[model samples]
Target: MILELNDVLTENESHTLSFMASSGELMCITGGTAASRTRWLLAIQGFSHISHGYVCIDGEPLTERTAQSFRELMAYAPERLTTLGEVTKYEPPTVQDVFSLKANRDIPISNGILGEEMRRTGADVSDGRVQLLAVAVLLDKKILLVDNPPKETSGYLKNLAKQGKVVVVTSDEDEIISAADQVVEI
Candidate 1:
């Protein structure tokens, strides 16, 4: 991975992150509260503008064409949660129902089975809604990006890391420094 930031941050501020991983190398970003790591995460997913530098995956620059192809692999679970309704299994539809709507019908996992998985993740299945479904979606992604995961959510992050690479961006130096196989100070 290659993260280049020249003027992306506030004036006179520096922003840069770079990581080259082997097959099982786990990389983490730990630094100041300038959101350099967060910006790097966004750029890796082709979400924000890189004013001066470019991000590349496996030597391939994150160009528009490449982004279109790799978009499906990127997933971000922001710190904020938005809910349209407070639903439950006893209501009009269950958590499984919402999951079905979000996921492709052809997927092997059924709504009921996925709902159980949601419950396993500490997400209340009975009154779960779109926000819960969003979690399910993130779990299925190849590259998961989480910002400043608190202690309560660290379990979820650990689970995601087991499934695939979990990129956590935070200013807490200790967390990233000790938790990751390769720690990068941005």
Candidate 2:
């Protein structure tokens, strides 16, 4: 599916954003504060309402009533939240724990596949950011929303995009931005 945001405006922030990424494309979102980047991703996923303009997929506009349907086609991975769950800086989540979440229970994840996915993506396995990214990749959704990804996974993310998945990553890292098919500084 093709993701499009045309002059979109948020409720709390007046900053307007416009972007698009078709299937097999990798779009990078850079700049702005962490909250702003998260807002953009949520807005695209139909959680954060757009005060103006539109967020559309395959030419169909995303609205409040259809937000859940839109989200069904997407998956998001946040780098770090205000409160780290059972974390003490470097206390990354275990693969088993991540997949144990209610939302992930339906996905068929195996031990071999789990280890391979993490290893293939070069996920640190000890860093929260990398762990989150690994989970996002495993979700295998049509649209992937990631925030603050490690630079080492650029190639994997690129490959994911090439596989016809719309990969939208939010980062300020030069490596990630440089590898994107398109870059937009929010």
Candidate 3:
């Protein structure tokens, strides 16, 4: 396994865990209400604080300093959604507004294909944020860390997975589990 965590339990009431991942594999985490699944993923990404245990990526011990580079090789989709530029909900941006960000312009995919992908994701964005995200990950060949993608948004993500590895953090849902090649519980 390229990713592995052993005997990793958290102190904040089941707030920690460990798992394994490898190239060409889609890993999904699922369990009870307080399973600490998200915490495990966050910890792997160096987003969560841990007092014990270790994270090894491709045989190297993961540390605070090395985490940044590892993180750059991955991408995160937060549970909450936001407009790229404007913060207010009232002036909320359409698809174009969020699609025009610096990162979006860097995608290597075709505009038409990317636009179709965004529409399928139900981002309701005409400007193609999801498309850009999908293409960017594909172009960079980075691992993806997605938070609870709605059924409507999963299609695009699934399509992205065909191009790169993905680590999805979901609650006690089985829909995405079927899509995973391996299931790791924390």
Candidate 4:
């Protein structure tokens, strides 16, 4: 799968970015707070619109009719409660709480999976780290977009990229930035 942003304009920023990411690539979008990386990530994930340029999946333009399907192929961490509405199931669900969601009822979840992934990544087994990795495992989304995960989890993010997943992250951590195959600064 491929994600391409052709001269895409931001909703608030006075800048435009053009980038292309393919499967097995780890891309990071970085800039000061003014960069509005979250908005860019939302646009890339098909949750919001770009005022200029275009975002496409495998050359197919992202449109209202296609956004839902596009979203199903991706997952975002630090979950967007307002957009997803999954919060209705519970208030600020943790990794364990997530498995209790009706949609996730059938999917197997265990502390071991989280532990092992964290162990492999060498990230501290904190609640924040578990939250990020849970999105990757439970949802099994081909594309992963996340807010600034700790630099220690860089290994797991890279593991996702190695598994042919397009990983786009909004981060300020030096190691995370250095590890990206592509970096777009808004």
Candidate 5:
């Protein structure tokens, strides 16, 4: 898997950034406000448009036509634990409920896989991280973009990188930065 952002411009200040990341790497994008971090992540995820230049996944330039497909191959785990609509509307919804959502219905989910993700992420059954990671794993997406992830999940992210997945996260935590394979200060 390859994620390349060439001459990309941020929406606010029009700041330019360019980098290329491949599988088996853990990249931390830091040094900015929460909003900026979110914007950068959105840019990479093909949710925000760059004024100049482009983003590429596996050498394919990201455009309106391919944005959805590109996004399907990535997962964004936000900082706050917002309800995932019906997926989390019921009390203590099971992992199967999450995969049952329309956006994730195409991917298969199982009890065994959920157990593994819960253990790997050190997240309890009710934790959103568990749900997010489980979905990302089940989809087998090449990229995992997380915002303000807990420290306990760092090891799990590293393991994902070792498995040839590109893990990019936004954080200001010292330990998280130290553990990253590369740090990009925005």
Candidate 6:
């Protein structure tokens, strides 16, 4: 799997960034402010439009015809746990609850995998973010985009890279940047 951004302008119109990554690599996008880091991740995930350039996956340019399929090939985890919705609204759902959703039913779920993810995130099975990350891992998308990942989860992200997942994380933290296999500073 490969992800490439060439001369891509972010939604803010203040920065143009470019980079490429292949499977089994951990890439960190860092620079400026927290917002810039988020924009870079969004742009790479094809959530934010590129004003002057293109994004490609496996040599295919991201066009309207292929956008949906392209999105299916990647999974994104945003910065804030709140963005994922209420973790305390009702009885805490288990990792199984996440995999049972329509969007994830097709992916096979295993207790071992769920246990590992729980351990990695250091989150209880009831945590919303933990459930979300569990789903992200089970999806097995070619690319994984995470924004402002928790410091404790950096090792888990790296392990994902080692497993041949193209992991892209955005942050301003020096420790996170240093832990990645490649760093792109915007």
RMSD values, in order shown: 7.9, 4.4, 6.0, 4.2, 4.8, 5.2
lDDT of each structure?
Answer: 0.50, 0.81, 0.58, 0.73, 0.75, 0.75
Off by over 4 Å in 3: 33-35, 81-114, 120-141, 152-159, 162-164
- Winning model by lDDT: 2
TM-score of decoy 6: 0.79
lDDT of 5 by residue, 1-186 (tens): 989888888678457777787899989988878778878888876666688888998899988889878877887666644444644321223455445656677666677876776777865657766666665666777798887777777787888889999999888888778878988888
Give the lDDT ranking, best first.
2, 5, 6, 4, 3, 1
Model 2: per-residue Cα lDDT over 94-179, one tens digit each: 45545555668988767677677778777586776766776677888899988778888888889999999999998898888998
What is the lDDT for 69 in model 5?
Answer: 86
How would you encode candidate 3's per-residue C-alpha lDDT over 90-173 as one tens digit per residue?
222234633465554576567677666556666656433344444444445356765555544544556556664655545455
Stretches of candidate 6 off by over 4 Å are 81-102, 108-116, 122-130
| Residue pairs clashing, model 6 | none
> Which has the higher TM-score value, candidate number 3 or candidate number 5?
5
The digit string of per-residue lDDT tens for model 1 on 110-170 reads: 6676665555545444543324434635346555555554433344445556555634434
Task: Let me know the TM-score candidate 3 reaches against the reference structure.
Answer: 0.65
- lDDT head-to-head 5 vs 6, winner: 5
C-alpha RMSD between model 2 and the true structure: 4.4
* Tens-digit per-residue lDDT, 1-186, candidate 6: 889988888677676888889999999988778777877776665666778888999899988788778877887766544423555542223444444556678776687886776777754556555656666777878898877776667778888999999999887777678789999988
Give the TM-scores of the predictions, in the order they appear: 0.59, 0.86, 0.65, 0.80, 0.80, 0.79
Candidate 3 structure lDDT? 0.58
What lDDT score goes with residue 6 in model 6?
A: 88
**Best TM-score among the predictions, by candidate number:** 2
Clashes of 5: 0
